[model samples]
Target: MLHLQHDRDFYAWANDSAAHLRAGRWAEVDVDQVAEELEDMGKQQKHALAGHLKILMLHLLKWRYQPALRGVSWRLSIDNARDEIAELLEDSPSLATKLPEIAARRYPAARSRASLETGLALETFPVECPFTREQLVDQDFLPDESASGQA
Candidate 1:
């Protein structure tokens, strides 16, 4: 009939958990809930990282495959994604090791999005991600019309 604080009010439960931890009330703390929350937090970080990577990859695809459409807006989008990804990595350095896997996993969606946005054939893009971790984060690493763009 009655739900627990965690199920009824997440915010209240979180605050209560914090208070319990602060007061060293080990018995009052919900260890299982806290562990689940922590695991969820890590998942959220990974999702954020994948999202940024997808945006960066989609824009890079547009820039490379449709050079004429390239302009300031795309550049800014790419830069902003890179900056956000960098900040995420800085806050959770352990996530840096997961970049390659995340990129690979997110690439197909990025490619499909690029194709839809640009009206380009999905086949036009590579099946696998073309950019490397170094290039993805480099502020000046815009792929050129003729080749991979660089500063």
Candidate 2:
């Protein structure tokens, strides 16, 4: 019956599961489903972190490679991504350990996205990620305009 509720109405299942756990009604709790949901929630956080990193890196790529086009919109986008990344890390400090890997894995996509958005050749971006993990979340770390396509 609880399994049915899980499939039919996830909101009810989640609330009921919490109630069961809180009330010491362990037998009524769908432990497996709860565990799956918890894992998925963690994955969602990681995915969000990856997404913000992509946005940050993309704008930085555009800022560096197409300095002529830089504007407040790009700066705001970078600042917002950094704020989001900082919040996510603060909420789950353990995720900080995975930042380098996530940044590396997400950079190629970000680079390609920057190229597509900026109308630059994909090769205009570096084969490797240019910013350090520290620089990525640093609010003041915009790449030098002179660095340009030398990436």
lDDT of 1 by residue, 58-136 (tens): 9999999999888999999999999999999999999999999999999999999999999999998889888988989
Residue-by-residue lDDT tens digits, candidate 2, 1-151: 9999999999989999999999999999989889999999999999999999999999999999888999999999999999999999999999999999999999999999998999989998988898888888788999996774322
For model 1, the stretches where C-alpha displacement exceeds 4 angstroms are 1-3, 148-151
The number of residue pairs in model 1 that clash at the backbone is 2
lDDT of 1 at 82: 97
lDDT of 2: 0.92
- Error in Å for residue 24 of model 2: 0.9
* Candidate closest to the true structure, highest lDDT: 2
Worst 10 residues of 1 by lDDT: 142-151
As a whole number from 0 to 100, the lDDT of residue 48 in candidate 1 is 99
**Model 2: worst 10 consecutive residues (lDDT sum):** 142-151
